[model samples]
Target: MTAGFEAIEYSSRDGIAVVRLNRPAQRNALDLTMRGEIGRAVEAIRDDASIRVLLLIGSGGSFCAGGDLKALTERERGALANRDRIRRLHLWFSELLNLEKPVVAAVDGPAFGAGLNLALAADFVLASPRARFCAVFARIGLVPDLGGFFLLPRIVGLQKARELIFTARVVGAEEAQRLGIVTEIHSEETLEPAAMAWCRRLLEAPTGTIGMAKNILNQSFNLDQRALAELEAYAQAVAMETADHRTRVGDFLAKKPLRYDWEALGRAEDGQ
Candidate 1:
């Protein structure tokens, strides 16, 4: 299914939902229309169980340059209105954070300001070697919005996060990988195929179990040990009740070939 959106393109094939940021001429800048389209597209993805994975990418060479500066400057709004606008963005950003299925960001070229935060929301970020990232909000005299404040510190350490934000430092894909920002770096030509292959590999596993675990892990830093233990118990109970769990267990007991043997799969893929 392909949804012809104005600022964004949404399509699904082979259980993968690809959300492409359009408007390459503007470097896929996030304008009001783009924001609204993204929210609607994500809502559609949330309601569709057939879409097992979400891949966010940019249409042109640049991923996203940032907000539409001209639009932002021309728009006149009071403090309350601006506050409301930010809150609306938070709602959709939170939706991405709480999404059950895996979200992969295939970032090529530059992902600056809010764009970087958008990529940070993904479960995995596969960046091209030419990918450039920056918290460019500082240069524009704006603090990081779009949940960048919340997401950055957790991925990179507090000190590193501060340096990136304070300095508005730009890092290439290799350095981003060193800082745990980019999960993997591929050549620009190979990035799309690599990301799709990774998604297919993920499709081999029990998605329900993985989604639940991701939910729990996302809250790990915020929850105390006791609270975490309680959540662990609840999550495990819910997982154990699933037929996928039971079937996998039965297969193990019967010495049958397992479907989600990640290590075995890795070895096979490596021709080991």
Candidate 2:
């Protein structure tokens, strides 16, 4: 299925929803219209039970070039107005960040500023060899937005995050992988396929179990051990009651193949 939007393309098939930034001419830059469309797309994904994974990518060989500077400079807005605009972004961004379903970002070219943060929001970032990432806010005399303040520091250490933000230096795909930014790098030709493969593997798991675990894990940094233990106990109790969990246990006792096995999936992908 597909939903038509001006600045973005939303499509879903076989449990995977693909949200592609469509403003290729501007290097898929984030404009007001694009932002609105993205929010709408995210809402669709959230409301649809059939959609198990989200694959965020960009058209025209570029992931995203961050905000459309031309659009931002076209008007002079008050500090209050700018603040409101950013707050609006958090409305949808927060949902995407805490989304129960897995999100995979397939980045090919530049993912700068807010673009970089968008990829960071994903559960896994699969980049192409030519992909580039940057905390470009400093270069423009601005601070990072789109959850960069929360996400970047968690992915890279606080010291590394500060250095990257201060320098605003572009990070190549290899360096990004080393810094724990990119989950894996594939060749340009295989980036999308690899991302889809990842989605397929995730689809094999029990969605409710994964979603519950993800909900708890997102708060692991903020919650104390006691709080986390309580959450874990609750989640595990819910998971144990699920029919999927019972079926898996039955399969194990019957000496049947498990429903979800990551290594088995890898071997199947390798044609083993």
Candidate 3:
């Protein structure tokens, strides 16, 4: 419903809401306008219950180049407004973190600084082989934003996260996989199909149930034992109310195999 962005485009197919960072010429840098557009799209998703999943990608050759340095320089003169601006940027990812449905990121060229943190905001990341990530905040004399500190350490271990953040080295797709930064990696040309496949996989499940699961998992990294148990109980209690889950549970109790076809995820299968 928010239509201000020729910068960020939002579209819905089935239950998946695809949010594209469209400023390729600047590598989708997080300027104030771009950041505000992202926030609006997130708010729109929160307002609409029909959307169940989100796929994030960039339009140009690279995913993003992080905060706009030119803007940063201007902000250094008055810094307070800049700090608030940075906080506002996280407001978008905060929505992502709190979304009730799955959020997937498809990485192709590069995800850097705040860009890297943006990818971390998602529940899943499917990367192209050419995809690369870097913790470039150090290079710019800044710290990671958008919950990087909380999410990165949990995903790749504390030591590895420190190493990457300190060194600011480029982590290629395979190496990123080794460190568990990406769920899977395919060819650059195949990223779109792979991402769509992932979105459709979620579509096959019960929408409300899937949304609850995503909500639980989004906070899974930081939950205490009692908290996690309570979250599980809460999800199970709510899931019992869904029609699909009711039928699925009955079938499951009857010892029937759950039927699923996940191969429709390939580019060739999708008519690539």
Best prediction by TM-score: 2
Using lDDT, give the best candidate's number: 2
| TM-score, predicted candidate 1 vs. hidden true structure | 0.95
Best-to-worst order by TM-score is: 2, 1, 3
Model 3: per-residue Cα lDDT over 100-134, one tens digit each: 77788999898998888888888788898888899
CA-RMSD of model 2: 1.0
Give the range where candidate 1 is weakest over 10 consecutive residues by summed lDDT.
262-271
Please rank every candidate by lDDT, starting with the best: 2, 1, 3
Q: What is the lDDT of residue 268 in candidate 1?
A: 62
State residue 117's C-alpha deviation in candidate 3, in Å: 0.8
The lDDT, on a scale of 0 to 1, for candidate 1 is 0.89
lDDT of each: 0.89, 0.93, 0.81
Which stretches in model 3 have alpha-carbon errors above 4 Å?
75-77, 251-272
What residue pairs clash in candidate 3, if any at all? none
Measured over all alpha carbons after superposition, the RMSD of each candidate to the real structure, in angstroms, is 1.6, 1.0, 2.9
- Candidate 2 stretches greater than 4 Å from native: none
